[model samples]
Target: MEAYWRRTAMWYGGVGLLAARVVRNLALPPAYTRLVVREMELMGVRSLGVAMIAAVFTGMVFALQSAANMARFGAEAYVGPVTALAILRELGPVLTAILVGGKVASGITAELGSMKVTEQIDALRALGVNYVKRLIVPRLLAALLVFPLITALADLIGLLGGAAIMFFERRADPWTYWNVTTYWVLPRDFLMGIAKSVVFGVLVTLIGCYNGLETEGGTEGLGRATTATVVHVTMAVIVSDFFLTKLLLALFW
Candidate 1:
């Protein structure tokens, strides 16, 4: 128990320090604009297909189930609003964060871990280049900038999916569905979801980078770090999600 707690404390301290450095060095000279843009393409544009697929399926399932329940209550017309609210408020952000978080986190960890084990990071340090600025900051900033957009895309695609299922399969009115959705889901709900994704992005990037920097044991350690990055980011995203939702609800609502 003592060893475990001690290790946990060390990890917390390390991650906290890494996060602080990232913020402090965020505006370093030269801007690393190209690197950041590259990361955004990798993190956001490359991730579009997966995010859309998840969103569509999510919206479809929720619409089907919500419609079934609402039908029993003679409230089937409200299914659109229910599905919209759920996706905008919770499903879209959380799901996008988790899924894309896993992919991006693992990639960052693997890339950095390989660099670390190969002494490439040390070489950059010897050259006076800030690894945090060059590597961590770009990825972190990219995640922060793109995650909200991804979540918004998820929300939009999800709505369309729900409309498709409802209009075609259930023969429901698409205009009414969209109208009810727009009427029920407020700006605050959308903002709340985007806010959650922002924090989640910070968590994902930092955790991945931290694990990569801490990696040891060469290739074996790289493997472990990548695996740990995925697990840690996923768990962090999920646990923080509850607190974020609670806090955002109080603040936004």
Candidate 2:
């Protein structure tokens, strides 16, 4: 039991230190600016299509479920708030992080692990290039910065998805849908979800980079690291979400 606790503590401590180093490195102006641009490209532009697709499907499915359920109670008007609350408070950020975890985490880990195995990382060291600054930091910055934007996009798309169902299949009154969405949805809900996503982004990057740096056994090692990065990141995101949700619910309610 003591041994397990020590290992767990060390693991989290290392993650914390890595995150701190990433933040410190990001404080340099030129490097920070470049990372921001690079991150926008990697996280935002690359992820737009995926977010759109997921959002549409999520919205559609949500509407189908909510409309069916609410119809039974003659409370179909509540569908808008149901969808809005679900997207803003839960599904939007969580699903967005999952997508980012799969897309960004695996790609970064594979790239870095391949470099580490090929001795390119060593060459960068020989040439006085800070690999963490050049490679890892950009990705970390990109993932951290872009995740919330992606979540925001997902939130909007999901609402539209629900709205589509309300307008078309459910034949819900558009004015009522609009009014409920605007009036009943709390601001804190969106803020909490976005805030959770940022934490998830940081965790994803840290875990991905750590896995890549620790990779061994050539290609096999790289593959293992990539897999591990995705799995651990997804799990961490969910676990963190549970705690954050509990804290927020307690504080707010």
Candidate 3:
């Protein structure tokens, strides 16, 4: 138990140090602005289709379930607000992070792990290239910037999805649904969800890059690191969501 606690402390300490290094390196040199834009396209633009698909389906299912359950209590009219609250406050950010994290983390770990195994990273260091600036900073910056944008879009698409279901399945009035949703959902709700996504974005980028840089043992090590990244990032996003929700509620709610 003591050993476990010590290891946990060390793990977090290392993560903090890495984050600090990322900050320091960003201001140093090369000013890889193009690379940052490239990463944004890779991490954000490529990820849009899946996030929207997930959002639409999630909204549909939630609206379907909520309407069914609430109809029994004669509260079906509130389904729009309920769906909006759930998606904006919790589901949109959480699901988008998990999906994009899982998709991108595995790719990052595998790509970097392969480089490590093939001594390409060593070659970069030998060339006097600041790999932290060249690699990690762009990716981390992209994640930080991309996730909130994606989540905001997902939130809007999800509400549209729910509205579609309400119209088709429940025959609820669309204007009423839209009005109720707008009334209940404050700008704070959007901000809260975006804030949570930003944290998740940081966690995903750091964990993925950390695992990749630490990869050893060649092909087998790459496989293990890739798998571990997905699991660790998913757990981190979810567990942190609870704490972030609490903190945001205290500050804003």
* 1-253: candidate 2 lDDT, tens digit per residue: 9999997788778778877877787766457566669767976798888887998799889988989988999988888988999999889999888886677888878888998899999999999887777877878777777889899989999999889988998888899889988888889989988988888888888887877777789998898889978888888988999998998898886
TM-scores for every candidate against the unseen true structure: 0.97, 0.90, 0.96
Candidate 1 lDDT over 196-227, as tens digits, reads 89999999999989999999999999999999
* Candidate 3 structure quality by residue, lDDT tens digits, 1-253: 9999997788678778889999899788788889889989989999999999999999999999999999999999899999999999999999999999888888888888999999999999999998889889999988989999999999999988988999998999888888888888788888899999999999999888888888999999999999988998899999999999999999986
- Between candidates 2 and 3, the one scoring higher on TM-score is 3
Candidate 3, clashing residue pairs?
none
Q: By summed lDDT, which 10 consecutive residues of candidate 1 come out lowest?
A: 244-253
Let me know the TM-score candidate 2 reaches against the reference structure: 0.90
Residue pairs with colliding backbones in model 2 are 39-142
Model 2 spans with C-alpha error above 4 angstroms:
1-13, 29-32
**After superposition, candidate 3 runs with Cα above 4 Å error:** 1-8
Error of 3 at 66 (Å): 0.4
What is the Cα-based TM-score of model 1? 0.97
Reference-based lDDT, residue 3, model 2: 100
For each candidate, C-alpha RMSD in Å?
1.1, 2.3, 1.4
Ranking by TM-score: 1, 3, 2
